[model samples]
Target: MSTSVVENLGPTVQNVPVTEATAAPSALDTGLTLGAVVQTEGTTFTLWAPAAERVELALIADDGSQRNMDLAHTGEFWTGFVPGVGHGQRYGYRVHGPFDPAHGLRFNPSKLLLDPYARAVDGTLDYSSPLIYDSSDGDSAGHVPVGVVVAGSEPPPPISRPVHWGETVIYELHTKGFTKLHPDVPEHQRGTYAGLAHPSVIGYLVDLGITSAELLPIHHFLTEPSIAARGLPNYWGYNSLGYFAPHAPYSSSGSRGEQVAEFKAMVAAFHAAGIEVILDVVYNHTAEGGFDGPTLSFRGIDNRAYYRLGHGGTMYDVTGTGNSVNTAHPQVRRLMMDSLRYWVEEMGVDGFRFDLAVTLIRNERHEVDTVDHPFLAEVAADPVLGRVKLISEPWDIGPFGYQVGNFGTPWSEWNGKFRDSVRDVWRNSSDGVKDLAYRLSGSSDLYGDDGRYPYASINFVTAHDGFTLRDLVSYDHKHNEANHEDNRDGTDDNRSWNCGVEGETDDPAVIALRKRQMANLMSTLILSTGVPMLTAGDECGRTQHGNNNAYCQDSEISWFDWSLPDAWSDHLGLTRRLLALRAAHPVLRQWHYFSGEPVVEGGRKDLSWIAPHGGEMTEADWYDGNLRTLGMFLAGDALRATDAVGNALTDSSFLLALNATAETRQVVVPDASWAPAYEVVLDTSNSMVTEVEAGATVPLAPRCLVLLRAL
Candidate 1:
């Protein structure tokens, strides 16, 4: 997700001497590293622009006085070392080359280009700046923001993710939205990186029982021209500019160089709390959108090498956000890889969730290929990054891009099937039982054949791009008029049910139904056999007033409401209970796909599907479109685990009975042979404790799920 507010353009960077800046590494190493490197004697600025004839570094002083230094060419890299022009120096590149837009060579010496590897960007982009576009006839000297040179520091010691994939509970949250409404965070620190690491915020996440904070994009991003023109912001932050630099706007420190340190401290804090920090990275496209877009870093540096060019030198818009980053190119691919490693090694981030990841694996011909994709193979084989969690969105807006089950091993995919199937089943749609079964079983049909474990599927019911859980059951259609696109921006395939009324209602019965449905969705996500991701504020009934696509609604409509009424206490409590139960039970989260075969001699198999009438699901029952109530029996004897000593782990068998119809249903329990006695462990109907016997029929409330344990 993007940030909404436009950060005001700040003062320019002040020059610092080599004595004040950090000393560079004296050990002979690969000099291929890009960006400005500070040294004890001098600072060396490097730029990789094979297409440019000459690249000049423009150093803007404290008084806005500019000095140009001609860079010496070493192979494809243009390098220049200037004594005393060390850290905190405001700088940008001026490339003089052919400016033929039709052939995609958009190099204009008039527009100062940002360093692609800038470690700290000082100011925000002004889209209205005429010089932002090379096609325009002016220079963009004082209008655009400049990159700051920073003396690199030692990276913090790695503290890898502590939780196993099977036990991972991802919480997707926007950095600003998470802390902007926090009651305890200091006002000055709110909505910043420092605020996110606040003790109160950490305490809430710990209490919510999530392993990783899959934060929205925090990279140096730019506000789009269209979004800025409408006086709206791209709060989602998908439009990234600098991959290596953390978005300075999120930093509370006024010093330009301190953003990197603040980001590292935030990651260190999360690591200390045993919470992994997984960045939502967007490498699919740069902020420099279509051909008509601005002459930012990539477009001005080497448009042909950085972006995929179509017929007549047009951009190959696979991501639907203008142009796709040409990962097929070796230099571009290396830039992405280097950025990922830098976050893990330098910033101490534990993992990454790639946005529109399909674009990264797509071939030069715009075809998705995992087999021979060099980038994919390199990431999966890298020593440092390979150990960290790697999650892919697995698709883009391109043709044949809906590759749900196409990702190779060692990479988990966000399970869109789980979201759709769960929504359909809870909405009581036709033939949803089979679909729900597939999802609850960890979508084995998608990951099983590849020899991947259940953890390969990251299951979830709601995420940032869709309606929040509160709105999912409160609206039948997307209410995104607030997005200001005539309600035509977001997707319309929301399989939601509004209970009895659309939007908010004072009707007690409708409110109750909505609560129950939300509870059902939460319970399913927590109990499903995969890595579950809980959207932030879902546990507390956070809402966007039915605005499913609030990507641009950056006001209170997108921020988390900390003032939830006492009526939502049950909802929060229910989510906590479900998560605790999921953690306590090994059967609920299996590492391996259920074999449906005996684990021990003369014992029942690990899993069994039961019809409402108590028998194993038959062919007719599986095909029944009207079927709403079903039971899943997980034999605890077959559920296996290992302790530190590698001893076998055991737990009580569980029987999950689900009823999605709008009326009470009599769900018959399995025979005594399956379990001589049973006790209801969880009831979404009232979050109450009750017991039932084997072979007995129990009245289950509509849109409720009951978890029973074999006694």
Candidate 2:
């Protein structure tokens, strides 16, 4: 017996080794490829089912003809090779084993199982069809998608001009939602991979000054039966089904294996444009829900091995999903590592943002341990994966899951605290000034002395899971009735402040206030000392009708509305200006924590907190719960950085003042004469620029921000 040309290299899918003793009876033994591995002569299909007494390959022909072929089992793997089968061949596996759901051994031969390592799958899943769960043989063949035998192809060369972490700006978006309604994209190409890679889309991102595009889950996912039956769709794509394959629906071409090439082409295009592609991956769990859920690939192949089985076979889910992937298991870890490498090496993606990543770092007993987790250490040491960016959601629903700042060096995390604290200050909460100061200054309290830089905090005031910047000031409560969960599914603690009304209103005063607040949040995010991730459509005020959890609203509720509102243009312009300011000022994105100590002798301190009374902030001023007025002085001459060409960089010293109260506050500049004159760079209240004399008292408007550059 000879091993297949393409053998399972990374830790074997099963405990079986790639030796002649563990090879199938056939001369061409495809050892543990675990899917339809297409060859020049034929296609060899393999599956891992250790508990199966027998396994059969059901090949569905192009003419809808069904051919059932027996497979030879050697150790834990079953292999079968068909001479005539070639690329585009559709097939699935049927395993015969014990079917006791209570004991977590569910091997129903009647339920045609999908290949867990399928690179491409044809057709869509009809969850309601009986063939999906029970044996309907030929009757079920049309209802369920079959794995397509795709020929291996090399990916384009890696991006040469990768964005550095210090200067990277992330734009988080949904693949379909981002361009689904863009006028520039063709109707046929809208919401497709081709559309996203279009020159028009690329140009918009470049103009927005975002170095990377962090897409929400684009992995092949299944729409939950409950949500689909209710006429709603899972717009977020969090429910992953096939980890190795890109979502076929996102491609303009048919699902007959063209999606793989289309996805790769999209990555290549982004790299060509010098923009990095970051995928928001969902590996914490699969679409297969709780114990009674559908028998998907993982559940049918190796239920006890792939998923964490709690007391008496019940799933110990930490991701809020019913079944959590048993990452502690060697085979499961291999599956994840292989999938990740495939995306980067074979698909050309630059990085990944793990959703509910805390679940992946848990021990075998389902205990969270960021320091000692085998997966974390493996990722840190992986030569291929270590070079690419690795971001973690940093929290799950389990105990000790909120390990935000606990991640080691080289790993950044979604700063949930930054989002909350920023919201608190603008909402005019008591003692919020201190929280705002901490977050705006790189969240030192969270990442301080942890061997991580300011970029470790991926800061955003609004994300896809919550209200958009527009809705934050428009709705006092979540109006998620459109989700069909009676508005009870989303979190009630929104921390949002409606300008004056609960929902949309015509009052000019309320609308004006809301616009100002949006500007405030955006300014704080870009000008702060950390990496900023702007949610798609947030710059143009795309709203979800107050539905924070628009995960299931696949219609206009989730799509990016290209038809911009009147105020949305202003919003977009403001965002562009603020990002431009961030790009110009290295002091705003300092790599090290500011110690209030001067870098150059006789120079100003790197940073200093200022009170409204023209003096440095005192202990008593910081403790004032009602203090809503604050100012910060940034020393540009201190800690100067160099450009890529090794040329020394210079920036202007800046003084930023904030007045979150209902009345104007006079902010006095320090009398130390850091600069002879200060020019107002931006004012959120008026969206204008002016000039002020040094040591002058600038009257900042109520609930507004003023940035002044020393001249």
Q: Model 1: how far is 199 from its true place, Å?
A: 0.4
What's the TM-score of every candidate structure?
Answer: 0.94, 0.93
Model 2's lDDT to the true fold?
Answer: 0.82
Instruction: Itemize residue pairs with steric clashes in candidate 1.
Output: 1-236, 1-237, 2-235, 2-236, 2-237, 3-235
- Which stretches of model 2 miss by more than 4 angstroms? 1-18, 21-34, 134-140, 565-567, 645-648, 687-689
TM-score of 2: 0.93
Worst-scoring 10-residue span by lDDT in model 2: 1-10
Please report, in order, the local distance difference test score of every candidate based on alpha carbons.
0.84, 0.82
TM-score of 1: 0.94
